[model samples]
Target: MAWRRDNSAFDFHFFRFFNSASPNNTMSSGLGKNAAGVLNMTIQEVYSSSENWILYFQSGVYFIRNYDYGGDLQIGVDSKTATQPRLLKRNGTLGQQWTLTKAEDGKSWLLTNGLLGKDLFLGLDGAKPVMTADKTKGTVWGIEMNESAGLPAAGNDLITSVQNLESPPVSSSSSSSSPTASQSATPANSQTAPPTTTNTGLLTSPTSSSANGITSSVEQPSQSLSAGGFEFDWGCCGVGFAGSGAGGKD
Candidate 1:
């Protein structure tokens, strides 16, 4: 039972702030519908500050996101790594290109852009709220009441200004490809007895490996933007993970 930091009160406060800025039907101008699909929040909602969805999984409604963008999306994580939790936008991509999958717990729903087949869940452990995956339990996330209901149906054009705080699917961890040259070769002495195989080994491999027989030894170099510049390399596994500027510019 991991212990949650008790942000429930804080989340409630955040919700009130966001709720105040919205209306029954925000699509005042009215645009094309979900030809692209329906997503969780609108780009407009994201930037409005007042309309941002609650992005945590406590007892209230929460937001979940997935970086299943054909492996794109990047964020300035730190000097060495471009955070692993950023979602890049598709060209001509609309922010509201997703739909919500109502869960058995009607209040909770899975937000998907209508492709890549995935859902959202609350990462809680033992009664304590934690930020990790629990494939069996469901992201178990909820939003501020019926905010999701307020969203337009399948054909409605989605609004921008929104972003979900969802995690990639449990399947994502299973299907994702881990880079060949990732971690520094763990010292033979550093190795721990393998845990149950049925479990993810979080240490298992994601993608393919190099000719060097699965690049068992790799080092995360000091992270810093190259003299060239600092930007996200969406099409690739991000510069930080691919090795300094792996997908970056020269």
Candidate 2:
């Protein structure tokens, strides 16, 4: 089978590959590294900033590159029988080249590795990213541009852009936990505890006020600290704290 370039389907821009089966999960280069120090590929909720990929089309196949580390490594399988994909050094091999075809659903694309005449496709095995001949598996993928990363070098006008895929709704827990102006004005001595690590290994610092829905993971100081020569009366949600000098302490 002759490999044909599908230029209209994808562009030479950075993108995030989201699995239609798991909307929240995207293609990630896991923390695990091989002897070459290259990261392994997995499908999971993005915890850090290294998940973006760039689909660079050349000759007839697309070279799927991990944005942050694409300069040295590209996505490829270890061997013809290997199931898991990894970020390997670009060796100009067919195993690193992938052909993307639009799935029947019309919203997702199927990534096929036509290495050694085997029509293995990139899919998810539970949370792991695997390659298999079964198309019925979680092989359909929806791709969206990494808008924050910006566009590619201008001048390549032949590249066609894919429609923006609907992103999963953001949860309240994903909201920014940065300190507010008032919180920043707190005395230097009144130090907030560092964010605690969750079971999933994500660090979160929350500070919330019951009066409002705003919440944060930042731990407030338990001991009362005076602000502006006035004793502060702390309350739940770290709000409604009154000072004795300005008003009667709660």
Candidate 3:
């Protein structure tokens, strides 16, 4: 699959504003504008240049985010959970240290010990496992690897680690019950979903957004902070960077 993205998939129906910042403050608030305000940011898939890179998220390769819970992986069904992160650490256990294993299809991938359910997602194609806020109990979540960016420098390596870790602007919960922890940060489904803001809103979604660029469509809004909103920096520039195109907060 080739890299194709539209900045108009993010939904702001339940969106609400919690705070309002000025050019002087430059600080973000976790509050929302509506009952369920969404965060403001862009989307860039990870792709590879040499062979198949990790930047291509749709290809099933990515640098694990939030490496604390159970995101580690090894090979085989009998594999056990390891101790550290794979890409960043050196002696991280096998469960924590894994490399992408692309099947003959060149699309589906199998994680070390990941079972989609009781048996793990088998021959899982298109959708790749990624680390996100939902990993409060584990170390990863579902994500499209190749679709983000990075090319040639995809996963399990530093090159593909491009701003992959840089989260967009969002509110953080100071309490142990931080709402951002359980948040999905992406959209859930298509049916009954709100309109996409990526190309639709023209970069005014986040209220912090301007009208000079494009943004990534949020697939899930897995967060709730006193009804306030949160935003993380989904790194992207040039072709699809953050600017006025986003439906940012006003």
Candidate 4:
């Protein structure tokens, strides 16, 4: 499925696929935005190059903002009992901010909320995805960027250009859950639901990316902070090595 910014509707087909109440059993707050907000997605082939998404933080934290509402992936207020994630307005609120950290293995990244220190996990065995303290195999994410998808590194200086934007605000939360236990971040659909892990299985090589001038050079020191009682590095998650455009084999 090719996802182009010029698409007629939302950000490709998955936007509607997940928004609907079908195979994707996850709960949605509400479909707020009908059109896909400006989406700049790219697919890479090799495993290491896929980790090159760190620059997204350099520019500013991203909301995991799905097309559902132009909304963000937020931690529900009742974290203790109902830790289920939701979609909310992109007002730069604390709960919506997320950091993509490089897990122990160079393959997967951990998605942690800025406000709530909980890790995002997809429910396996027909369970709905939720944010919780469970560090089971479900929490690790095997992300990949490739050619099949239409989104690519169309312009140069894509990463640097994003650096100009203001970062999201930091917020405190009552949820002090610690990081979940480590698990192999493989592209396994058995842990996280297939719907959410479709791209995970697509791990490949750096066929292309919007990050042209964004070299694999060292980045500015990142700010360290404590959120929801857990200490973590802000904007300093894992960084990926530069790769060739020809793409490598699986």
- Backbone atom clashes (below 3 Å) for every candidate: 37, 7, 103, 12
lDDT of 3 by residue, 1-250 (tens): 1112211111111111111111111111112212111111112111111111122121122223211111121122212212211222211222222233332333222333222221232221122222222322222212222222222211112111122222222437433211111112222222322222222221221211111121222223232322012232233211221221222222
Task: List, residue by residue over 1-250, the lDDT tens digit for candidate 4.
Answer: 2111111101111111121112312222322222222111122222212212211332234334332221122222234324444444333344544555555565345666655654443322223445556666356544332223222122212112221222334438635322221222111111111112123332223323233222333233223222221222212221122221223323
Question: Please, what is the whole-model Cα lDDT of each candidate in the order they appear?
Answer: 0.23, 0.44, 0.21, 0.30
Candidate 1 Cα outliers beyond 4 Å, as residue runs: 1-51, 54-85, 90-96, 113-115, 119-134, 145-250
Q: How much is the lDDT of residue 127 in candidate 1?
A: 28
Model 2 weakest 10-residue run by lDDT: 241-250
Estimated TM-score for each candidate? 0.23, 0.52, 0.20, 0.37
Top candidate when judged by lDDT against the true structure: 2
Ranking of all candidate structures by their lDDT, best first:
2, 4, 1, 3
| TM-score, cand. 4 vs. native | 0.37
Predicted candidate 1 versus true structure: per-residue lDDT over 72-106, tens digit per residue? 12111122211111233322122213333344543
| Candidate 4 structure lDDT | 0.30
